[model samples]
Target: MKLHWSPRSPFVRKVAILLHETGLDAKVERVRSVAAIATPNAAIMVDNPLSQIPTLVLDDGTALYDSPVICEYLDTLHDGPRYFPAAGPARWAALQRQALADGMLAILLIWRQERMKAPGQQLPDWLTAFATKIAASLARLEADAPALANGHDIGHVTIGCLLSYLDYRFADLDWRAGHPALAAWHAAFEQRPSMVATRPDDAQT
Candidate 1:
């Protein structure tokens, strides 16, 4: 399998963490592919029309895309504990958490793009809305922090990645200030071998 990957993408980091947890890191070859919202890469578009990272091309020319689908597909390949619960309330909760985290990530990506624009070209309303949404997301995660200890799932991985991304790109926001419980949870999760190994700063550019 070959993965169209980028070192800095949280979505790609999710897949990388899963690969490590499942002992499948060696099974997939990483191809450094640059995928930007403003300018899509032709290489990635060949595998994923959206030009997204973490696009996995299997041996028989089958392609799996977006982080969630790829991670779930890889989960079936290993015998270890499942990152996705097989069924019941646990599965729904995990999936819901993943959706929240991924939604925040999507907002952060666009917020970042907006930040990159010249000050005069930036929209004030959009900036304010982005900040508001992030704060609300943090509050939701804070409320759900206790449930995070129940099990390590795709939700945990995705949330940890999102918090780390905040530290990586939005340090000025001081996200931990009002979310003590969530911060504490992330502090420990960030130390996992998978998380440490895939740190965006530590990745080779």
Candidate 2:
């Protein structure tokens, strides 16, 4: 399998961490796809209409997209118990965690857009919306960080990526300060080899 990849993107990092955690790193090849957001990447758009990174092209030439879908596909490829439980409350909880993380990413991207444009081009309304969403999301996650009692699950992976992104893009926000349990959870997750390997360099991929 070939992974359409870029190291700077948090979404891409999520998939990379999962592949590494599941012991499938050797089986998958990482090809640095063109930068679609900063620069037009026709090849990626050809494969995926959305022109998103972390698109997985299976051995048979089928392509998968977006971080969540790619991660789910990776989970199925593994044998034994899945990182994502197949039934009941486990699946719902995992999905909820993933959604929260995904929402965090979306808000960060919006903030990035507002920051990147000309100083006078800032979108105030959009910034306010994104900021509110991010604040609420983090508060909830901090208050009740997902439990990882039975080894690492998809929820853990999602939260790990979310926290890592905050550190990478919005370190000044100091998300760890107001939330002690989340801080503790992130401290433990930071020790994992997968998290270490996928740590954001923020120095351009």
Candidate 3:
């Protein structure tokens, strides 16, 4: 398997963390592929029409994409309990949490792009919407942070990766100040071998 990857993307980091956790890192090769709203790479689009990274091409030439799908596929490739829970409430909660984390990433990336674009082109309405969504999401996560037990499943991995991105890109926001439980959980989660090993080394996209 080959993974279209980028160190700077939180979504890609989620997949990388899962691969390490499953002891499946060696089974896949990482190909550095950069994708962004303004800068799209045709090579990645070939495998994933959206031009997203963390696109995993299986040995048989099948493509799995966007972190969540790739992580689920990786989970099935390994023996033992899956990062994705078996059917029932456990599965629903994990999927819900993952979706929440992905929403945060989408808003964050768009905000970052807005910040980078020419000041005149920046949309205040868009910024307001992003801020509203981010605030609500974080508040919800903070209140529910206690549910994040020690399980390193897909939900936990997605949250961990999102927390890292928040710290890296919006450190000035000081999100941890208002969210003690999440702060504590992430502090411990960051020390996991999978997370530690996959930490982003570069600030560049």
Candidate 4:
């Protein structure tokens, strides 16, 4: 399998961590495909019209997109439920947590875009909106941080990646100040071997 990936993408990181957690990392090959909001890579477009990172191309010429789908596929390859829930409320909760993490990633990406603009190009109102979204999302997550088990789940995988990206790209944001619970959860998640292995590269930032 070939994976179109970027080291710094939280979504990509989610998929990569899932593969490792499922012991499927060795089966996949990483190929860097830069397809940002502005520039779409032709190589990725050939396989995935969306030109999204973490796009997986299977040996049988099948393609998959988004972190959720990729992770679910990995879960099936392994015996027992590891990266995802098998049934009932646990499944719903896992999906819900994944959504929250993805939403947070979107907010952070928006924040990054606003920060990247020239001093005069930056929009205060836009950033304020993004910050507000971040605060609300974090508050919701902090209120009920998922209890992670020994094996990786979608909730743990996504949350870990989200917190790592926040640390790497939004270090000055002080996400820990107003969201103590969220900060504590992230601190605990950081100690996991999966997180330690997937820490963001400083050079990528």
Candidate 5:
């Protein structure tokens, strides 16, 4: 398998962490693909029209895309603990958490793009809305930190990546200030071998 990957994308980082956790890192080759919202890469568009990272191409030419789909597919390949619960409330809870984390990532990406524009070109309403959503999401996570300790699932992987991304790109926001519980959870999650190995600053492959 070949993965269209970028060192700095939180979505890609989620998949990378799963690969490490499942002991499948050696099974997939990481291809450094640059996918930007403003500039589409022809290489990635060939497999994923959206030009998204974490696009996985299999040996038979099958392609899996977006981080959630790819992560679930890879989960089936390993015999270890499942990142996706098999059924019942556990599955729904994990999925819901993943959605929340992924949604925040989407917001952060757009917020980042908007902030990158000249200050005068940035829309105040959109900026304020984005900040509001992030704060609410962090509060939700803070309240649910206890549940996060039950198991390491796709939700945990995504939330970990999301928080790390804030640290990486939005340090000025000081996200850890009011969300002490969530911050404490991430402090330990960030030390996992998978997280440490895939740190954006140190990523090479």
Candidate 6:
């Protein structure tokens, strides 16, 4: 297997963490790729039309993309345990949580991309709207924190990566201000072997 990846991508990091947790890291080859709105890598487009990082190409030349789909596919390769709970309320909850976390990532990426443009080309209202969504998303996660368990798989990993990215890229937001439970949970979660092993270079910001 080959993975078109970038160390700085939170989505790529999510997949990296998943591979590590499943003991599948050594099984896949990592091919460095850059992906961004301002500078999209044409090489990646050969495998993924969107030129997205974290695109996995299987042995038969099948390409899996984005984060969630890639994670689900990798989860099936291992038999040790399942990150995606089988059908039931738990499964629905896990999927829901993953969606929310991914949505937050999208909002943050939008915020950063807009700010990267020249000030004259940026829309203050759009930036403000993205900020609002990011804040609301954090508040929602904070509220959903206590129920979080240490053994969580994909759902928990999603939240962990998103919060870490926020801390790394949006420190001015002060997300930990009143989110005690979520902060505490994240503090412990970051120590997991998967996270510790894949911590990106400081330049990831």
Could you give candidate 4's per-residue lDDT for residues 77-189 as a string of tens digits?
87755667888888888888899889889888878998999989999999889988888887787777645443457987788888888889998977788777677778887
Task: State the lDDT of candidate 3 residue by residue for 1-205, as single tens digits.
Answer: 9999888888889998988888999988989998877788999988999888879999889998778888888888889678899899889989999999999998999898887789899999998999899999999999879999746579999999999999999888888988999999999999999988888877655
lDDT to native, each model: 0.94, 0.84, 0.89, 0.82, 0.94, 0.89
Runs off by more than 4 Å, candidate 2: 146-151
lDDT for predicted candidate 4 compared with the true structure: 0.82
Residues 1-205, model 2: lDDT tens digits: 8888887888899998898888898999888886556676788877787778988999998999988899999998878568788889888888888888888887797698787788688888887888788889888887666465445678789888888888888888898888888898899888999999988765755
Worst 10 residues of 3 by lDDT: 196-205
Better lDDT candidate (2, 5): 5
Which regions of candidate 4 deviate over 4 angstroms? Answer: 146-152, 202-205
Off by over 4 Å in 1: none
Against the correct fold, how does model 5 do in TM-score? 0.97
Runs of candidate 6 exceeding 4 Å displacement: 203-205
Residues forming the 10-long window of minimal summed lDDT in candidate 1? 196-205
Clashes of 2: 0
What's the lDDT for candidate 3?
Answer: 0.89
TM-score winner, 2 or 3: 3
Candidate 6's TM-score reads: 0.95
TM-score of model 3 (CA atoms): 0.95
lDDT of 6: 0.89
Query: Each model's TM-score?
Result: 0.97, 0.93, 0.95, 0.92, 0.97, 0.95
lDDT of 5 by residue, 69-150 (tens): 9999999999999999999999999999999999999999999999999999999999999999999999999999988988
RMSD of 5: 1.4
